[model samples]
Target: MRWISKPLPNNDVVNSLSKSLGIDRVLAQLLALRGINTFDEAKSFFRPNLAELHNPFLMKGMEQAVQRIFTAIENNENIMVYGDYDVDGTTAVALMSTYLLTLYPNVVTYIPDRYAEGYGISYQGIDFADDNEITLIIALDCGIKAIDKVAYAKEKNIDFIICDHHRPGDTVPDAVAVLDPKQVDCHYPYDELSGCGVGFKLIQAIAETLEHPFETLIPYLDLLAVSIAADIVPMDGENRILAYHGLKLINSNPRPGIKAILEQVQKTELTITDVVFIIAPRINAAGRMKQGIHAVELLTEQNISLAKKFASEIDQYNADRKELDKKITDEALQQIRENNEEQNSTSVVFCETWHKGVIGIVASRLIENYYRPTLVFTKSGDKLAASARSVKGFDVYNALEACAEHIEQFGGHKYAAGLTLLPENYHAFKNAFEKVVKETLTEEQKTPEISIDAEVDLSYLTPKFYRILSQFAPFGPANMKPVFKATALRDNGYGKRIGKVEHEDDLPEHLRLNIIYGADDKTYNAIGFGMGHQLDEIQQAETFEAAFTLEENNWNGFTSLQLMLKDVKC
Candidate 1:
């Protein structure tokens, strides 16, 4: 792995902001790195205000979508709130359906079966809507590429108001309104919304239409924040505001569904990372293991007892998902070794009986060992389906587009995507994808690089400095957790390899250290996960440079700062 220090901010801007805010220069420099040049921008960054969110009506199809929904409400028409099977889709369905049911009684949610319907707007889902006498369908997190399915719904007199964030095709669906910000014609100021974020915008517009105060919609932000985190969208702009307040709700008074899920964990305050790890997988496990609607049911349940029951059931599904993915990942790694394809630019493996639900997770797991673009395929009916994951700085979607001739259908964004193809075309498509990635990936892009925000000395990591840095919460893609590099660091002789000793020959999984920077009488506690192999290097070197993020560690009711080391260089 390569350690790349980010470009330093302009000295003028950093000094000016530091003086104006009366903050540490390091904190000001961190804000400057995130493009906060002035006091106002810094305030907005630190304290995200919901009022600053863009007007929903600014979206290209917002007016039409709101009007269509209002028409459905006025006529008491049955409205089907439809979405994909993942966390973003289910949370979007739960948010939209529950909100619509507040205004009208004839609303229902539809999450297509993962195995039968595959993904996105499906014919089976449309048929279900038609059978239920639903006249209007509000599709969320999907439908940008559903030209045919939308037309099929139209034939049944069902109007579509799509709220999606995926990239649109050459031609969008003929829905009443397509509210994807990715459309070139749509000029929404911030376009990096999660699917649930788009769903929130729709309801924001609806709430405004009814002249309701903005606080009426605050309760729904928890769902939006979950979607934003689970879908891995940028944690800046609209997402930051939504996640900030949503996290507050999660920690203070979450909905029964979320509360029940939280009951299983021991956290007092949940961060965005906690939401991703604790809540998302449970909600997603319902879809991956059973039916997507189970997640929606859990999210929408009002009864605490029933919600706990649902949470328990979903927890089992998550457990099953974990076991299956680990087994399949082991099988996939073995396949790579058996085929002697370890040196390939890409890792593409397939099995006829591999569970379709776990392929995506397996693909990601493969990347941890191989460190390359990966695709894990499984037989989906007559065709083969795959989940694709890419390394840092690589666009899997564009790479799939280059191999479109072999793909029957594909969708998703830069880092992750899903695709299907005929079984016969798998090898050919795999070769083509390998070629595309090999040709496009620069040498630096192939290796995972840790981007360090700034270089700092041990003295700069004071309690006050950390307090200011903690304000940069809810970190994700665009606004990541800050990583700082400290040079001339020596381990205080107590450093050692740590973690479980599984077997006689098994390698230790982590590194523990009391990092000493200077003769300041303070030895900083540090832990480097998966860096056990570096124990010898650290012990031999008199001093080295370390890249790490500062975090608070709590043990036995005592809390102190800890360095989460990323890498070390001598």
Candidate 2:
């Protein structure tokens, strides 16, 4: 792992901000490095306000999209809300469909099956809309690259309003309006909205047209928060504001579906990370294990009993998904090993019978071991569909675009993408993709990076400092939790492994230790998960250092701060 230190800001500016904000010089320096300079910016960073959100109308094509939707509602035309099968896609479907149902009765929702119809706007979905006499389709989380599908829908007298955040193709789809900030002509101030964020903006515009207050839409933010966390979008600017309030709703009074899922989890309070790990997976499992409609049903279900049943079903789906994912991941790893391709320029593994629902996740898992551009493929009907994930700084979508000749269709962001090609073209595409990565990528781009936010002494670690850091809540892709580096230390003798008095065959030993490290030599205790193997190493060492985050852990009616170690070096 590579520890890359970002270039720091000038000392004079850091000192001034530190003095003005009444924060430590190191904290101020880190803030400045992240482009937070003025007190107003600092205040906004600390307290994300709903008032800070940009006007929904300011987004390019938002006005046209809003007018088209209002026209459909006024004419009482049958409308279908179409989305992908992932958490973002399902959440967008739930949010838009539920909001529309509250105001109109003609709205319906549809999510394509990941296994059968694959991703994005499907022709089968279009046929269902046509057969039902649906005149309007609001495509969310997808449809940015559905130019042909949009044209096909147009032939059936159906109009489309695409609310997507994926990177756009050369020509925008022939739709009523395309609301993707990644479009070159789009001028939305923030370009990192999750799929559901775009859906929320669409609903916000509709609410504005109906003369309803924006507060009427606050309840839907929980869906957006889940999508934002799942899609790994940046949590800054308006996105942060959405997540901040959305988390409050989750903690205080979540909707029936969310509450049902949270009841089974062990955590007392959930951060954005917790939502990503716990809630997003269950929601995504609906899509991955079955159709994404189960997810929408779970999110929109009003009855507690029905919601609990849906949650329980989703939990099972998630468990099944884990098993299938593990099997496919292990097989892919074995394939790479047998082919002696672990040291290849890129990692491309294809299994004709692999479960189509979980290839994207398998692709992501492959990156952890290979640390290179990866593509996982499965048979989808006569063609082969694949999901691509890339190392940092290398744009997988662009590389896929470079090999467009072999691809039947493709669309996604810089880091992640999805594509389909003829089964016969898989080997050729794989070779071309590896060549592209080998030629274009630098060696440094392949190594994983651990970014240290700042360096601090143990003495600077305090409850007050932790509280200040907590103000930067709802951390995600762009706004990450602060990681500090502390070095040079001797144990203060407070270190000891705390566990049960006896050993049982089923129960493994757990490590809980207190140790002091730094120039000041202040005392602190640390908890390491799955680190019992390190007990012997730590016991034999006289000095050690670690990169960690200070967090408050509460157990058995007592709350105290502890160090959550990321990496330990002795």
Q: Give Cα-based local distance difference scores for all models.
A: 0.93, 0.87
Q: Write the per-residue lDDT of candidate 2 for residues 1-570, one digit (tens) a residue.
A: 677666778888898889999999878886787688888899898888898888888888999998898799789899999999999999999999999999889999999987667779999999999999999999999999889999999999999999999888789999999998889998989988999999999999889888999889999989988998898888887888999999988888888999999987855589998999999999999988887899999999999899999999999999999999999999999999999998887999998999888898999999988999999998888898898989889999899999999999987778888899998898899999989989998988978877888877878877888888788777876778888877775556555555564445434345667776655556688876645557667767887767777789889998878888766667
For each candidate in turn, the TM-score is 0.97, 0.92
Model 1 misses residue 349 by how many Å?
A: 1.0
Candidate 1 lDDT, 448-550, residue by residue in tens: 8999998998888888888989999989988999999999898888998899986999988899999887877579999999999998899889899999999
| 10 residues in a row with least lDDT, candidate 2 | 501-510
Best by TM-score: 1
Show model 2 residue runs off by greater than 4 Å: 266-268, 401-409, 425-441, 491-513, 518-522, 528-542
Candidate 2 lDDT at 138 equals 97
